[model samples]
Target chain A: MKVLVAVKRVIDYNVKIRVKADQSDVDLTNVKMAMNPFCEIAIEEAVRLKEKGIATEVVAVSIGPKAAQEQLRTALALGADCAIHIETDERAESLAVAKLLAKVVEEEQPGLVILGKQAIDTDNNQTGQMLAALTNLPQGTFASEVVVDGDKVNVTREIDGGLQTIALTLPAIVTADLRLNEPRYAKLPDIMKAKKKPLDVKTPADYGVEIASKVSLLKVESPAERKGGIKVASVDELIDKLKNEAKVL
Target chain B: MSILALADLHEGQLAGATARVVAAAQAIGGDIDVLVVGEGVHAAAEAAAKLDGVSKVRVADNAVYAHQLAEPMGALLVELADGYTHVLASASTTGKNVLPRLAALKDVSQLSDVIAVESADTFKRPIYAGNAIATVKSDEALKVITVRTTGFDAVSDGNSAPIEVVDTVVENNQSSFVKEELAKSDRPELGGAKMVISGGRGMGNGDNFKLLDGIADKLGAAIGASRAAVDAGFVPNDMQVGQTGKIVAPDLYIAVGISGAIQHLAGMKDSKVIVAINKDEEAPIFQVADYGLVGDLFEILPELESKL
Candidate 1:
């Protein structure tokens, strides 16, 4: 069985993003970019599946501009047999991305697909479910742990209340959440070797899927910021403010 | 436009988040309908019917929807989405799980975590982990939206809408429930809690989390933890509050030992009053805090517990 992992290039998690002065969008000019943290976890799980001999070959696919190749290369350095980049400058929504991925799956016929639960940039958390629905595949989302046993895959999900364990048949879609596994960094030597691996690029039209963005970003703005109050010198002072000034006590 | 809002369930009752979603739908000026799907959920359905501005409530009581797993529940939503021009739900785990599937079946894009309903077609959502808010306009004929409960106030119980039974069941053989371990807490739910006390990596260990218990009980505050605390095994994952974890905006949020990483701030920064307690005076959380207390949590917690 082959494993397919979908990765996305997004803003680094550490960066404190700044909204554009015009209220159009977040300023991305010269911003540090990296593989989405959750996407890294997805690729890590896919590579582990290959290491465990459950997957014969692991393929990493990304949908974005040319810079997205960096994320695909990172996936290769971490251990993927090949990389497929759906080269598109258009910022496609989850629906269009899922449709494009469904087209790729039709041709690749991978037994399993792993994706990040949500991209840190968009925080939409919809692509995996949309892909599963479009492809008519069973979906296991927000997966904290996954185990493969014969023709079934057990996915333990980190849910709202606590945890839920669900079993899905083979050829399924699983979206990785946190605590799935600690992703390892690619070694310097592995990064060099990743350049020699096969990396293919295709336009969204190559899959015959329309990449029209369904949502128009009308405006962007920073959230309301709360100004800091004076620091309390003692516990009694804090209590006085909470009871009298803030009235929250 | 006709709108359908799905009632979120919590412990066999209609979740408070449902009213917020209904309010968001009503903001667009539409005939709002609500769907309650679960086993023995008539009480939830009744509560949903009482939500102001809700015109109708559709209840589907079945074992298949007990957990609202994505497979069958998604199919059920798709089946009921025929004539509706808009579908909305609280951006809870169930909403995140099922809305995209319904949108895919209908061949449309879903707007997740909508914070504001600008028009019938336009909405506002927080992207980049609440660091940036994006106002988006959807071109799809049918819009699917998952509302962030924190954005809108819950509609009060004023209406007496009629409740109807939905008899549609889609066969799902692809996935099966194994088991669930829900964190049982007698304190108020984290999202709706009046006071929230969260610990961070500084708490050091799981046993130290008990230090907050007395104060929590005294204040009737829900207990939460930063991702650092959860990662260190000082608390369970469910107690985590951050961008990836549960988003909460309580009336009073006291953060202990948390250095105010952007992720943690994204979850609780919306609290009406934020109090940061940390030993480091230069902690980033102090910038967004309404009140800052600089001290060792171990020493301060004991004193504060006594004072309370």
Candidate 2:
């Protein structure tokens, strides 16, 4: 069985987000970029399956500008057999990215597809489910654990209150949660080997999908900053203030 | 505009977040109807019908929806999506699982974790873990949205809207429920609690989490943990409070030994009053806290519990 994994390039998680001067969008000028953390977990899960011999091949696909190839190369170095880049300049919304991945899924016909639950940039946890909808596949989202058994896959999902385990037939979609697996770093030798791996670049139009966004960003701004309060000399003072001044206790 | 709000439920009871979703829909100015989908959801449907501003309650009771699996739920929503202008649900796990599929099947875009309803077409949502707020406008005729319940007040329950039975039963063979392990606790849920006391890596281990229990019992507060604690195997993921975890905004939030990373702050910064107790005076948690107490949690927890 072959596994297809979707990765994304986003502003590094450690960088503080800054709104542009005109308030059009976030200021991403010269900020560090990296593969989304959750995507790395997704890639790790796929590679683990390949290592276990359950997956015959692992393919990594990404949708973004040319710079996204950096993330795809990172995915390759992390153990994906090959990579595909859906090169585009538009701000690919969840639905558009899902559509592009659906087209790739149709062509690749991988037995299983894995993706991050949400991209940290948009914080939109929609692409995996949308791709499943478009492709008529069952989705086990927010998966903390995934096991392939016979012709079925058992996905343990991280839900609101607890964990839920579900079984989906072959050729299904699974989205990785934070606890899925700790991603491994690529070695120097593997990074060099990744440079020689085959990378196919394609456009959304090539798959008869348009990467146009339906939602328009009207403005972007920073959240309200919380003011620091005075330090209490003792717990007695904190309790007194909570009960008297704030009246919340 | 006609709006349909999907009711959030737990064990066949309507979840509190459903009321907040209705509050968001009311902001959009519509004839709001609530949809309750689950097996044996008659009581939940009744609860939904009583929420203020609800015009009606639509119930789909079937075993297929017992687990609220995304496949059947999405199909049911698509079948009922013909006349509604907006479909809304709380940004709970169930909503996050199903709404996107409905949006895609309808060939429309979804606005996730909407914090503000600016207009019928415009919304404000937090991106980059609430570090940046983006105001977005959707051009789709049918808008699917997930509401971050903390951003809006839950509507009062008084009105008695009519309840209608939805006969649509979607057949799904792709996935089947295997089992579930839910944490059972008598304490108020973290999302709806009035007071929350969360610990961090400073808690040491799972056994040390017992320290918060005394204070929690005294104040009737819910117990939470920062992602650091959860990652350290000190607690379960459901107890995690952070950007990637449960977003909570209680009347009073107590951070015990928490260093307050930005991701953790995103979940509870909207809290009415925040109190931080940590040994390190320079911990970032003090910056956002309304009251800062510098001390060792091991000693502070017992003293605070006794004083309360």
Candidate 3:
């Protein structure tokens, strides 16, 4: 079976994001960039499927600025056989990205598609499901556990409720949840090998897909800083403060 | 201008988030029409009709909408949204699943999880897990948005509006619904609960969650856990309350032994009142908390339960 995984480049999870001075966008000048952590998990899952002999080929795809090619290369190093970089300087929203991915899906008819539940930067958990809807495929989103049988894939999803186990037919889309698997660090040898791997480039226009903006960002601002509260001495004082001052008890 | 809102219903009742989305729709200009699609969902449709600021309730009753799967729903919404300028839904699992599909199918960009409506075409949303807020303006012909229900008040109950039956069905038999293995919990649901009591890795064992039951019951709160507690196998993923987990804005949020990681704070910082109980005085939770109790939760929880 063929598996396609979508990866994204975003600010590293550890770096605290800062709003730009003008509050129009995030300040990205000095921030450390890395592949989205959940996307890394998706890459790890696809590599595992190939290692288990269940998948014949794994292709990693990224739609972002040219710098996002670094994320595709990282995916290749992590174990994706080939990579596709849809170069665009536009900061595409989830719907636009999903449209681009759906165009790719039509060109490359992979039986299974794996992607992160959402990107850390946008946090719009939409692409995988949108792709599934566009292609008329089943979607098992926020999957913590995925098991493949002959033609059926049983996915245990992490939803608002507890775990929900859904059995989908072949040719489905699954988004990786946090607890899905721990992604591995790319070894130096693999990184060197990834340089030699096949990397294909495309554009959103190549697929005749138009990214229409529905929401325009007015400003980006830091969240309201929480003020520090006075520390109480005794449990009784805490109770008194809660009742008299806070009135939240 | 009239805004069309989609009501996400499971079984036969309005999801709690639907009212919040209605409230968001009311914040923006115009008459609101709510659409309820599902088989045997008349009860839900009727319930949605009762929400304030709703001018009309459209019910699309069909067997294909049994699961109200994203594909069919997207197609239906596309057909129904031809005249409406704005389409809104709660940013719940259902809304997140369906609206993006509609946007992609319609070749329109979708704004996910808006926290505030600045105007008809502009909104504010949390980008980096509530670390930063982005105010956006849309120039698209049609605006597709999912409202972060926690950021808005739910429409008050009263005044049932007229219900309109929309006879629209789009057939795309691409997927089948398999049986679901839903994990049942005796406690209230995390997102819908009025109060929440969450524990972190400091809770120690899986069984230690029982100690929280007394206080939770006293406060009528749902039980939640931090990612650390969930990763430690002390609780299920559904119990997780954080950036990557469920975002809850309850009346009161009691964080027990939780050292307020930024991710954890993202989910519950919108709570009306926050109280932290931890041994570490330097824990980050104290910063956002309205009340702080520096003590071991294991002892304080029981004592607090007795006192309550």
Candidate 4:
């Protein structure tokens, strides 16, 4: 069985985002970029499955500008057998990315597909479910655990209340959540070996998919800042403020 | 224009977020119809009918939708979405899981976690972990959206709407529910609670979480934890309150021993009043807290509990 993992390059999670001066969009000038945190978990899960012999090969695919190859190479260093980069300069929305991945799924014919539940940049948790709908595949999203057993994969999902386990047939979709697994950093030797790995760069037009924008960005601005109040001298003062000043009690 | 809103339910009981989603639908200025899809969802459908501004309630009762799995639910919504101009649901786990599939099947883009409805097609949503807010406009004919319930006020139950049974039954052979382990608690749900007290990595371990119980019981508050606490194995993921976890904005939020990260602040910063109790004076939690008490939580928890 083959595993196809979709990775995305986004602004680093640690960076404080600054909106552009003209309010057109977020400023990406000289910003640090990295693979999304959730995508790292997805890659780790796929590599672990390959180590366990449940997956015969692990293929990593990413969609972005040409610079996205850096993330695919990182996936290769983490243990993906190969990488594919869908080159697109236009900002690919979730639907466009899902359509591209559905095309890739058709060509690769991987038994399992994995993606990050949401991207840190857009914070939109839509790609995996959209791809599932487009490809007519069952989906186990927000998965913390994936167990492959005899043509069925049992996925333990993290729900709002607790955990829910569901079983899906082969050739399904699974989105990695936060607690899925702790991602491993690539070693120096592996990083060197990743440079020699085969990487295929293709355009969205190559797969007959158009990367078009459906949502227009009208403006971007900072949220209202919550100002900190005075520090209480004692617990009694805190209670007094809550009961009398704020009147929330 | 007609709008279809999906109800959020658990164990046949309607979730409070459904009312909030309806509130968002009402903002769109349309005839709102709520859809309840589940096994034996008559009670939930009746509850949906009572929400203000709802004109009708559509119920699809079937075993296939018992878990409200995305596959069948998405198909059912696609079938029922011909004349509706907008489809809305709460940005809960169920909505986040299913709405995108419906959007894709309809070939329309979905605006997720919409915090403000600027117009019929424009919305304001947070990006970059709530660091920046982006106003977006969708050109798609059919608008699909998931509402951040905390941003909208829940409507009161006043109007009694008519209930209609949806006869469309979707067949599913691709997936099946194996089991579920939901935490049973007497406290109000964190998302809908009036008061919330959350702990973090400073609690040390799972057993230490018991300290918050006394204060919680006294204030009638729901207990939550930061991602650090959940990731540290001090509590379950369901109790997590952060960007990727439950987004809660209660009337009063108290942070106990929580050194707030930005992600954690994103979930509860909208709270009416925030109180922070942590040993670290430099903790980020104090930045957003309306009242700050810097001290040891071990000593503060008991005193806070007894005083309340």
- Model 4: CA > 4 A from native: none
Q: What does candidate 4's lDDT look like per residue over A1-249, in tens digits?
A: 999999999998898889899999999999999999999999999999999999999999999999899999999999999999999889999999999999999999999999999999999999999999999999999999999998999999999899999999989999999998999999999999999999999999999998887899999999999999879988899999999999988
Error of 2 at B271 (Å): 0.6
Q: Give the lDDT of residue B23 in candidate 3.
A: 92
Q: What are the root-mean-square deviations of the candidates from the true structure over C-alphas?
A: 1.0, 0.7, 1.9, 0.7
CA lDDT of A229 in candidate 1?
77
Poorest lDDT segment (10 consecutive residues) of candidate 1 chain A: A225-234
Candidate 4 chain B, poorest ten consecutive residues by summed lDDT: B10-19
Tens digit per residue, CA lDDT, model 2, A1-249? 999999999999899899999999999999999999999999999999999999999999999999999999999999999999999999999999999999999999999999999999999999999999999999999999999999999999999889999999889999999999999999999999999999999998899888887899999999999999989988789889999999987
Off by over 4 Å in 2: none
- Would you give me the overall lDDT of model 1? 0.92
lDDT of 2 by residue, B185-250 (tens): 999999889999999998889999999998999999999999999999999999999889999999
Compose the digit string of candidate 1's lDDT tens values, residues B113-145: 988888889888999989998999999988999
Residue A178 miss distance in model 4 (angstroms): 0.8
Q: Candidate 1 vs candidate 3: which has greater DockQ?
A: 1
DockQ of each: 0.87, 0.91, 0.66, 0.91
lDDT by residue for model 3 (B123-220), tens: 99898899999888888788889998888988887968999999988785554565555557666778888889999988988899899999898888
TM accuracy, model 2: 0.99
Interface RMSD (Å), each candidate? 0.8, 0.6, 1.9, 0.7
RMSD of 3: 1.9
